[model samples]
Target: MWDTEHNNGVLIYLLVPEHAIEIVADRGLARCVAPGEWQALVSQLAVHLREGRYEEGLAQAVDAVSARQAAHFPRRGAGTAYANELPDAPAVR
Candidate 1:
């Protein structure tokens, strides 16, 4: 659930197969995150992706890139869209 209002709330759910109750208590996570901070999170996620830590990479990617700009921004294979995307390709190993 995307809570733009930044309200603190917990999501409680029951796991049938595990036969347990899952409680995601929002203590720190519910707080509003800044854009730069979020960008840093994305950078970290890319690092994680490079390191082959798939789960961490995915978490960081989703948290970082999942923004208003994501919709307008191209996923890949393009000629310039955002300023971040360089026109020239980097040297490949």
Candidate 2:
């Protein structure tokens, strides 16, 4: 349900109770990124979480997602500038 400008947005749901994670990417980004790539991030998160590194895991996830996003929808200044369409803070509910 998380999507933004250029239809490029991703949401990583960390289900603490169920001890699982869900990665959701919009159609625009979905076509650009491989599912395996997303899986690897999820797996990485799990590993960090398993070691009780909640903050570190979340931080890594953000960095990883940013790298992937930069690849597909790079920042173009002035002429084709980018405006963040979604909130920077993570959604909990």
Candidate 3:
């Protein structure tokens, strides 16, 4: 989370065995987002997971988080390119 340049990194962790989800955001992003918004996203993801839609749920969660990040930390210019600081794929253990 602290590795991102904009300090807006987010991690969505899913505990499959416990059917639990956790969303961690960096300080910059956390201050801009309300707790209820995070809870709402988690609730939506939980619904999809409970229905056995793991991939769909995860994809939606990623999209939602991306949208939030974009809204809070937009690119500086239309032609500007930013490096992806985090891995694109999720690491499952």
lDDT of 3 by residue, 14-86 (tens): 8888878999999999999999999999999999988989889889999999999989998898899888998
In terms of lDDT, the poorest run of 10 residues in model 3 is 1-10
lDDT per residue, candidate 2, 3-70, as tens digits? 47677788888787899898888888889999999999999999999999999998999899888889
Worst lDDT run of 10 residues, candidate 1, spans 84-93
* Strongest candidate by TM-score: 3
Give the candidate order by descending TM-score. Answer: 3, 2, 1
Superposition TM-score, candidate 1 onto the true structure: 0.30
- lDDT per model, in order? 0.43, 0.86, 0.91
Select the stronger candidate by lDDT from 1 and 2. 2
lDDT of 2 at 62: 88
If the candidates were sorted by their lDDT against the true structure, best first, what order would they fall in? Answer: 3, 2, 1
Instruction: List runs of model 3 lying over 4 Å from the truth.
Output: none
TM-score of each: 0.30, 0.87, 0.94
Candidate 2: stretches off by over 4 Å: 1-3, 78-81
Residue-wise lDDT of candidate 1 within 1-93, one digit each (tens)?
Answer: 234222223333334355433333243343444446545654565576567686666554444444523433335666644343222222232
Most lDDT-accurate candidate: 3
Ranked by TM-score, the better of candidates 2 and 3 is: 3
The 10 consecutive residues of candidate 2 with the worst lDDT sum are 1-10
How many backbone clashes does every candidate have?
0, 0, 0
